[model samples]
Each structure stands twice: as structure tokens, then as C-alpha cells.
Target chain A: MSIHNVIQVEGLTKKFGDFTAVNAISFKVEKGEIFGFLGANGAGKTTAMKMLIGISIPSSGKATVAGFDVFTHAESIKKSIGYMSQKFALYDDLTVKENITFFGGIYGLSRKRIRQKSAVLIEELGLEKVANKLVGALPLGWKQKLSFSVSMIHDPKIVFLDEPTGGVDPITRRQFWEMIYKAANQGITVFVTTHYMDEAEYCDRVSIMVNGKIEALDTPKKLKEQFKVANMNDVFLKLARG
Target chain B: MSICVANISKSYKNVKALQDISFNVKVGELFGIIGPDGAGKTTLFRILTTLLFADNGRATVSGWDVVSDYKNIRKSVGYMPGRFSLYQDLTVEENLQFFATIFGTTIEENYDLIKDIYVQIEPFKDRRAGKLSGGMKQKLALCCALIHKPKVLFLDEPTTGVDPVSRKEFWEMLKRLQQKNITILVSTPYMDEAALCDRIALIQDGKILEIDTPEAIVKHYPKPIYNVSANNMYKLINSLNAYQYIHSVYPFGEFVHYTDKRAEFNAVELKLYLESKNLSNIRIEKTVATIEDTFMELAK
Candidate 1:
């Protein structure tokens, strides 16, 4: 495998009993690339993502994440990647500082390193005034931003974001994408899934999954051209509806 | 008017959930409440549906006062909350039957009301509600909401987290339902869906920012907007934000929707400035403002 490829998969498949949730899917994610993984509801996106994040075992096929094999080095893969989902990221009862410290500890950061990182993160997000407040008390936009920062506390090689900007205001949503762009510029591979089609255009490459199989995979421009559509939303509607 | 809310205000301890909110929905019109989460949309829906009382002001639904005539309002209106409130353990058919029974009606009496939507999920009638897929569950929820054949329908963020195809299908169903003379008050965070409504009210932080047709709302934007693009999106945004003439810069799809602080701005000059910043392949074109752009400007 080339050193530039951070995530590599070959015919990766996941099945439950008689049902195949994720069919044989193969894709590569390059270093610092923003990859948008999109699909319709019940399209096995969650199943595929679970396998990539090392949380679930793949029933068949070969995959490597962050230079670690999915079958043999799952724990190492976990250590080399960060994950944040819209539903659950940070603890509501914990303060912003406490959430940071707790996640830092989970990633096995040194106490001194955690302290230094927490200071920088709090300042960067302008959360200094709310550092002591419970995460639940903060606005939805603030909590999502903080959750993303805490996910990167360990400085993993790749970060997985699941619908991170769902239901956010238009301004805050753009700010969130700006943060994503910054992370990518700093050489972190972003594997994100979102329901918003406009966000699909922001990715360097996007893969559309349908019925447990990948139906389309390319840059947003190429996908639009290939589908003979003006935008990603129409492209999505055509493929998913079919 | 099918629904009318006047000078409504509600508070929970320190948070003002809704403040002096007022709006009117014409009969048989598809009205939308467009806002993000915690914008007091659900609070307004609750008050109008008579599930919760406002600390001040009053509302009437289907010609009945929300408080004094809540019983009549509840009987004449259908409400689908944001969360899936159906019984998880019940089968789809059972759930539909239960709703029809409660409204003192039968499936045969109102089958025509939900025929198009219900037929899509009819094959899954035997499946448990909890086991249905996201799209199927939404269709089932809509079916339950319409089983009573009410004159008004209240849908709260029905398309939140739902995919594009299903969302499109859901909107089409709403348009068809409008022909039946049902006034629908739907709320969604998606600006794209706002255009599908006959009229929309943009709300934020316990207040209504603006209310008008989506076309009129976009025209309310005070400045010209431009679709600016370059080879490097990240660097392009930072450089434009650092420029002196920048009024607002927000990333929209493949390009950044930008506006200038000056009244008579030159695109060539701005392109030259970006070129000096080592950016290449710069493209700038005048673009129409969208509901999202108008919303951000109003919310700002």
C-alpha cells in the first residue's frame, strides 16, 4: 500500500445471519482527504462505519485503517483514530474541561499534555468562560463544536464525524465546516457522513451507498457530471430512488 | 384563518422559550416554520396544539381557542411531534387501527385521506413499528397523523435526519394532502424545504426573524451576493475573510457565498487580491441570495 493512503479496503463485507448489511465494498482514503460517506436511510452506512472504526468485526474481506489491520490490530486501529457522532459525543453532565480531560485520558494522553491541550482547545473555541459549565447547558452549536475538538484531543491520524452538523443554524454550520477544513489542512483525514447534500460538495471525494452496496464513488464534480445533474442533491435522488 | 396565534409568550425559569410570537395560517395553505433547534418552534407548536399553555396571549385552532376550546381543537387537528411517539411494540396495522379508534372513526372511513402514503407502507403492516426503517417509520407516522382526517396537520421537523429521496417524497405527499383542504403547519431546519412552502416564518432564539413568501424573503437581503470559488477552499475562505472589503463570507456548497462591504465593488480587483495571496483558478460570479443567506443575515 502507498504511504499516502490512510485507509485501504478490499471487498470489505459485513453480514448478520442471512442478511448482508454491508456488501463487498472497496475504497481508499488518501491522507488529509475529506471523504463524504453518504447513503439513504437503512443503506448500511452505519454498519460500514462501525467496521471501519474498529468497533465491529467485518464478516469478510480485508481492510486496514491507519496502517493497522482490521482483523488483527483492532485495538491499535482504535488508538489511531477519533470518532464523534451527533447523537453521542460528550457527556452532558460533565463540564467542558472535564469532558476534555476525560477523553484525553481515554486516548492515553499524559496528564501534563492533557492540561496543555485543554488550555489551547478551550481558548481556540472561545469556551474559556464556559469551561466550568456543564456541556448540557451550552447551546447545541457550542456543544457540537466542543465535541469535535475533544474528538481530536489525541491528535489521531483520522477522525470520523457522523452527521456533525445536523440541525445546526446556517452560520454555525458554516463555522463547523470551517473547522473541518482547518483539520484537513493540518493533515488529518476526515471520514464524515451527513444528510445534507451541500456538505457532499465540500468533500474532496464522496461515495454513495445504496442497498448495502456502493452505487457511485467520485469527486462531487465528477459524480454530478456522471449523473447528468446540476447538484449533489439531484444526483443523490436519482441514484437512491433507482 | 385555520390557525391564529396572538402575542404568545412562554418561559421556563430563565429561558424564554417563546416571546411575543404571532402568526396566522390560511386555510388549505402549506405554512412552514423554518428554524434550527432551540428556536422555540416546538414550543409554539405545543401551545397551538393545546398540549401546553402559554404564560401570556392566546391561540385558536380550527376556530377554537387553544385553552378554552382545547377539546374541540384536539378533535379537529392532527399533530405529529418531532420524536417518534408511536408505540414501538405495536404492529403498523395495530397502531393505525388504534389511532382511528380513538378518534371515533374507522380505517374505512378515512382510507382515502392517506391512500397514497399508506399504500407505500401497506406491505409492512405486519412489521413492528420499532423494526421499520427510517423512511418507513416516517411514512407510518404520517399515516397515523392523518388517520383521523382532521382539517389541520402539525408536523414538527418531519424531515430531520431523513435522506434526500425520502424528504422529497415526503414533501410531495404534503402537496397532495394540501389539495384535500388540510392546512399544514410544518417545521424544518432545512432552508431548501422552506421554498416548497406557500409561505414561511424564519424563527431564531425565541423570536420570529421574518415572515413572508420564500421568494420575498430572499429579496429582503440588503446586499449583492457572489458565488466565489478557487482551487483551495480553505485558503480561499481565510484570504477572503482577511480582505478589507469583505462584508460576509459563508461557505455554500462548492463555492463561498460572499458579499462586499462596499456598494460598488469590483470583482476583478478582488480576484487580483486573491491572486496576490498565491491563489489560482479564481472564479467569481453574481449569484442570487437563498433563504439560508437571508436567514443568516436576518439572524445576525
Candidate 2:
């Protein structure tokens, strides 16, 4: 594997009984690249992501995340990467400060380091006034932003975001993307999945999965040209519909 | 009017969910409530559908009071909540039959109303609702919601988390449903979908920001927008934001949508400034305002 490639996969397949959830998908993600993983609903995006994140075992495949083999070093892979999903990320009952500190501890940071990190995180996010409030009381946009920050508290080499800006307001959604750009500029690879096509355009490269396999993978401009469409949304509609 | 809401307000504990919300939907009109999550959209929908009560003000559906005449409203309107609310254990066909029976109607009685949508999911009629795919489940839910042939339909974020293709198909189905003379009121966070509605209400922070046709809303933008692009997106955004004449900078697809604080701005001067910052391959062009632009301006 190349030193710059943070994630390398070859013939990665996951099967359940008679069904193949992810079929022989292969791709490489370079360091600090924003990779967009897109597919229709029930196209095995979640399953493929699960295998890559080291939470699920691939039935038959060769994959490495952060230089750790998925089959042999699953635990190491989990520790080397950060993950946040729209459905579940942070504990709602916990306060913002507590949530940040808890995630820091989970990532095995010392108590002193956790304190320093939490202070910086609170100030950076401008959450000084609401740091003591329960996360459940915060607005949806604030919760999403806090969740992203908490996921990165460990400063992993790569972060996986699943629909991070699903229902956020227009401005907050843009703000969230700006945060992503900052992370990428700091040399952290971002593997993200989103339903919004405009957000898809923000990625450096995008791979569209259909049925259990990746049918097309390229930059937004190339994909648009290859499909003879005007935008990513049209390309997606043509591919997914077919 | 098919639906009327006057000064509706609701609160939960210390959080104000809805405040002084008012709107009216004409008969056979395809109206939309466009907002993001926790914007009091669900609260207003529940009150109008008679599933929940407002702490103040009043509402009516089909000219009947939502409180005193809830039973009539319930029978005359179809509601599909944001989440998949069908019985998971039951087959798709069985769920539809059950909903039809509860409404004191038969599938044959209202077959024409949901024929277009139901046919798409008929292949999975024997499958349990829980086992269906996301798109199939959405179709099944819509089918059940229309089995009774109500005069009005209330869909609360029906396409939330759905893919772009399915979202387009769902909107087409709604347009066809409108031809049958049913007043449709749907809510979604997608600004693009707002254009499909005859009129839309943009809501945020439990308050109605604006209510007008999507075209009119875009025209309300006070400044001319420009599509600005450079080789590096991140640096371009930062440099634009740091510019003295920058009014607003938001990243659109493949470009940054920028507006100037000055009434008469020169694009050439801005291009030269970016060039000084070591940016190359710069492009700037005037672009029309979209619903999202209007929404952000209003919300701000």
C-alpha cells in the first residue's frame, strides 16, 4: 500500500446467508481527501461503512484502514479512526462539557488532556454559555456541530460522518461544511455520506454505490461529464434509476 | 379555505415549540411548510390534524373546528407522519386493508385514489412492512394514507432522509394526487422541493419567517448574487469572507455564492484581489437567487 493512502480496499465483500450486502467493492482514499460515499436508500451504504469502520467483519475481503488490517487489527482500526452518525452520536442526557470529556476519555486520553481539550473545544465552538446545559436541550444544529467536534476530540487520522447535515438549516449546513473543510486542510481525511447532492459536490472524489457494488467513482466534474449531465443530482438519478 | 390556523402557539416545558403561527390553505391548493428539524412544523401539523392541541388560538379543517369537530376532520383528511408509522409486523397488503377498514371503507371503494402509488409497491404486497426497503416502505405508507380517499392530505416530512430519486418520484405522486381535488399540505427541509408547492411558508425558531410563492420569495432577495469560484475552494471561501466588500459568502455547488456590501461592486477588482492572494483560474458570474438563498436571508 502507498504511504499516502489512508484506506485501501480490494475485492471487499460482505455477505449474509444468501444475500450479498456489499459486492466486491474496491477503492483507495488518499490522506486528507474528502471522499463522498453515496447511494440510494437500501443500497448497502451502511453495511459497507460498518465493515470499513471495523465494527463488522467482512465475509471475504482484503481491506486496511489507517495501515491496520481489518481482519487482523480490527481493534486498532477502531482506535485510529473517528465516527459520527446522524441517528446516534452523543448522549443527549449528558451536558456538552461532560460529553466532550467522556468521549475524550473513551478515546483513552488522560484526565488532564481531557480537561485541556474540552476547554479548547468549548471556546472554539462558542459554546461557553451553553456548555453546562444538557445536549437534549440544545437545538438540532448545535447538537450536530457539537457531535462532530466530539467525534474529533481524539484527533484521529480520519473521520467518518454519516449524513451529518441531514436536516440542518441552510446556513448551519454550510457552516458544518466549512468545519469539514478546516479538518481536511489540517490533514484529516473525511469519509462522509450525505443525501444532499450539493454536499456531494463538496467532496474531492465521490463513489456511487448501486445494488451492492460501486458503479461509478470519480470527481464531481468528471462524473458529470461522463454521464453527460449538468450536475451530480442528475447523474445520480440516471445511475440509481437504471 | 380547506385549512385555517389563527395565532396558534404551543410550548413544552421551557421550550416554546410554536409561537403565534397563522396560515391558510385554499381548497385544492398544494401548500408546503418548509423548515428544518425542531422548527415547530410537527407541532403545527399535529394541531391541524387534531392529533394534538395548541395551548392558545384555534384551527379548523374543512371548515370544522379542529377541537370540537376533530372526528369529522379525522375522517375527511389523510395524515402520513414523518416516521414510518405502519405496523411493522403486518404485511403491506394487510396494513392497507386495516387502515381502509378502520375508515369504514373498502379497498375497492377508493381504488382509484391511490392506484398510481400503490401499484409501485404491489410487488411487495406479501412482505412485512418492516422487511421492505426504504423506498418501498415510503410508497406503502403513502398508499395506506390514501386508501380512504380523503378530501385533504397532510404529509409531514415524508421524504426526510430519502434519496433524491425517490424524493422526485414522491413529489410527482403528490402532483397527481392534487388533480383529484384534494388539498395537499406537505412539509420538508429541502429548499428545492419548495418550488413545487403552489405556495410555501418558511419557518424557523418556532416562527414563520416568510410565506409566499417560491418565485416571489427568491425575488425578495435584496441584492444580486454572484457565483465565485477558484482553484482552491477552502482558501477561496476564507479570502472572500475576509474581503472588505464581502456581504455574505456561502458555498454552493462547485462555487461560492457571494454578495457584495456595496451597491455598485466591480467583479474585476475582486478578481484582482484574489489573484494577489495566489489564487488562479478564478471565475465570477452573476447568478439568480434560489430558495435556499432567500431562506437564509430571511432567517438571518
Candidate 3:
């Protein structure tokens, strides 16, 4: 892995009213690494992601995404990163090709460039035959893959996936992780948050958020060894319980 | 049988929601209906709960026919739909009272049955159901469902979208309920949760793949599998997939779960091959099967 850090945060915090959704947390993510951010629902995982993605302003802290300050260069950070939220950002009514074209247009890609990228993407995912099929008509697995590929259509420096594999069958989930691996292989830093502890095992490193504070951060193997647990799920259970 | 389903089938237009599905739950057993979305879990739940009818076959819940004895079934069974169906505008306390009154009983009459689950949410009694957190809302829903002291409870995806901590607590609540001899039939898409059930019916495309204890199902895994990982997981998986002798390759946790067609596979030889491919930090070990592994094998 490269020593270059794509993301850096120190004493980051966010508060709403009296509740601190994210406490003073500090961490750094290296370029070309898969970083897994974990927490239970309402554990500030979403809040932290929003702050890092530059959508939500942090109450206090220092952070940067892709060498751009999250506070001042939020707009530049937005342009330099791609985000795939839990609720898919695809237009279900649109055909596969149409969805790609629309997202490409949103990213300001030229018509010719969009066409080129769409062709390569369709061929890569074996969606050549269903390129014109409505996204709603495709199976859950196909739609997930299509949504992920669309997120990378712009080839940003980093990609953030929030619960990308929820509700997908085991087979489809495996296939989706393969896509994540390929993206990381191509040197795109992957920042992902998931409820599925098993997915944590695939990351180069992970940080577990509890309440509003980052309780644990390390390689998955080390975290498991430190907690003296058989798997990531037990590690999470122990942390969440505490 | 606390619940019995025999040759149940249902269809909506051209789509078959359920097909010849059958299962039984003994009194006090925690039965699980496991499947993904569109797997007909909701339809089956609706049928048993008397909210919908099956086009064919028969079912009985709590010794009452779902069709002929709908009224009795409704009285003896508590049903919690997949989605949060309680009144969003009502306060937590008000929702519980409304359910209790509709069942012709006061909360005081069955307070003991719901006390363990309800006490946690009692502090939020004034909070609107919509304003409560996902976990708190689930607890209130469960409280209202059990307010009438129903003999059987049906919870559809109770833990979906809940945090890991809340999910664990909810399952503990289910176990506590089982002590009162309340036959619980729960459904979830999460394969790990299947292990918590006494017996689970794995469903896919509206068909039952297997019905057995989680342990027995894992014991039946057809192949000896290996957990394999290397510095570059992407390359490791690709190499495994391209290997002629490999039968199946899927990502499992931090490693790739591998199966080979050969009777006797050599882990060292495979390691040497991966080494030649310039893959470092390789780790391979025999691993026991899990519900997810069994589910994938059966799904294929």
C-alpha cells in the first residue's frame, strides 16, 4: 500500500442540539486501501461519513479529502469523490443505458466519452444484452452491480459505499465484493460502512464507532486478535455491548 | 402443532408468491422463515396471520384453521408485519393501549406478558412512534403485539435495519418470550440470524430449499472447503476461479472460500501456485461451514 494518505481527520466532531452524533475522532486512510467504517444504527457512522464526504459540516475538527480541506474545499472534495448510499441513486424507470447516460451527464462527461465508458462498463459486467433493459426489471444482484459501476463511472480518487450489500443474497454479495476488490486493485481508495461484520474482514483496515467515539481502529486480523474473538461479529458485539 | 402449513400455494397475477410450501412449528419452538426479498416470506406470513388467503391448501395457527377459524386464529395469535405498522402519530403508550383495547383486554390484564419488553420503552411512553429510534419502535411494536397474551407470535423481519446491538437484544427478547410457551415464527433475510432459530426453513423464489436445525444444515455441506487469502484478494480470487481443478470460489469474510473437484486437494500446492503468481501474505486453512455457505450451496 502507498504511504500517501487520501483522507486525514483529527479530533473530528459533530453535534446536533445536545447530542453528539460523532465525537472527537481521528484517523487517516491511505491511498489504494480499503477502509471499513463500522457501527450499529445510530452509532454516528452515517454522521461521520456525511462530514467526510463534505455534505455535513463538522462542528469542530480538522479533516481533508483528497488533499482538499473538508471545511473550505468541500465543493472540490465533492467533485473528487464518488458516493453510493444505501438507498440506490439510480432511476429505476430508466433503462440501463439511459441511467448511465444521465449519471454521466450529471458528472459533465461529454456525450462521446459517456458512450465510450458505457460500452466498456456494459462489456465488463456482461450487461451487453440487457443494456437497454429497465433497471427495475433487473434482479437485485444486477441492479447492485450496475449501481456500483455507475458510481465509478467518473473514476474519482476515492469511493464511499454505505451498506452496499444489504439484503443481497450471499452469492450476489460475493460478486459485489469482487467489484470492490477490482476498484481497490486499480488504486481507487475504498471507504465503506456496513452492518455485515463479515464484510469487515475484506478490508485492509477498519474502525469501529460506538456512541459517537471511535472505539477501535486497526487491521481486521489485529482487531480480532486484540479482542480475543473468533470473528469480526464478536468483536463488534463486545464493543457495542461495552 | 402450534402452527401447520400443508401444500400452501398462492399467486398474484402471473407471479407465484408461494408454491406448495409446507412447514410446522412445535409449541414453544422458535421457527424461522429465511429468504431474500421477494422470497414469499411476507405472503406466507400474511396467510398464516389471516390477513390474506392462499389459493390452495390449508394452514392452522394455534389449533385454529386460518381460513375457517379466522376469528379464533386472530384472537390466539399476535402478528407483527415486516414493516412497522403501528400508528406513527400516536404516542408509545397510546399505541399499546389501542392494541390492548381492540383485543377486548386492558394492558393491566396482560401486563406480565409484555412487562419485560415494554418496560424498556415505557420511558418513551410519551414519544411519538415515528420519533423513536428504529430499535425503540421495534420494542414498542413487540410490546403491543404481546399485550393480549396471544399464544403464538409472528414477527416478520423484526431485526431488519436494526443495529447490531439492538438486533442482539431483540433476539434475547425472543428467547425470553419462548419461555412462556409462545410459539414464535420469525422471518429474516440475514443468514446469520438463522442460527438462532431452533429450526429454519430456507426459502428462495418461493420454494423451500431445506428445513432443519442450523447445525444439521451446516453438517450437510457437500464439500470440504478452505478459507484462502493473500495480499491481493482480487488476484487471489481470479487465480482460484481460473484454476482448472477448482469447483467453486466465493468471498467469505476476509478470505475466499474455495472448493475443488478433486477428492484430495493439496493446500501446499495451491499455496505454491499462488506464490508463483506473485501473491504474498497468503493464508489458507480448513474452515467449518456456516449457514451462509450452506445457503449458497443450496441456492445453486
Best by DockQ: 1
What is the descending lDDT order? 1, 2, 3
lDDT by residue (A1-242, candidate 2, tens digit) is 99999999999999999999999999999999999999999888999999999999999979999999999999999999999999998999999999998899899999999999999989988999999999998888989999999899899999999999999999999999999999999999999999999999999999999989999999999999999998999999999999
TM-score to true structure, per model: 0.99, 0.99, 0.96
Q: Write the per-residue lDDT of candidate 1 for residues B1-300, one digit (tens) a residue.
A: 999989999999999999999999999999999999999999999999899999999888888999999999989888999999998999999999999999999999999999999999999899999999988989999999999999999999999999999999999999999999999999999999999999999999999999999999999899999999999999999999999999999999999999999999899999999999999999999999999999999888
Tell me the spans in candidate 3 whose CA falls farther than 4 Å from its real position. Answer: A1-3
CA lDDT, candidate 3, residue A229: 92
Between which residue pairs do clashes occur in model 1? none
Model 2 Cα lDDT, one tens digit per residue, B144-252:
8899888899999999999999999999999999999999999999999999999999999899999999999999999999999999999999999999999999999
- The TM-score of candidate 3 is 0.96
- Residue A167 of model 2 has an lDDT of 92
lDDT of 3 at B262: 95
Residue pairs whose backbone atoms clash in candidate 3: none
DockQ of 2: 0.87
Query: How close to the true structure is residue A212 of candidate 3, measured as C-alpha lDDT?
Result: 95
True-contact fraction per candidate equals: 0.91, 0.82, 0.65
Error of 2 at B104 (Å): 0.3
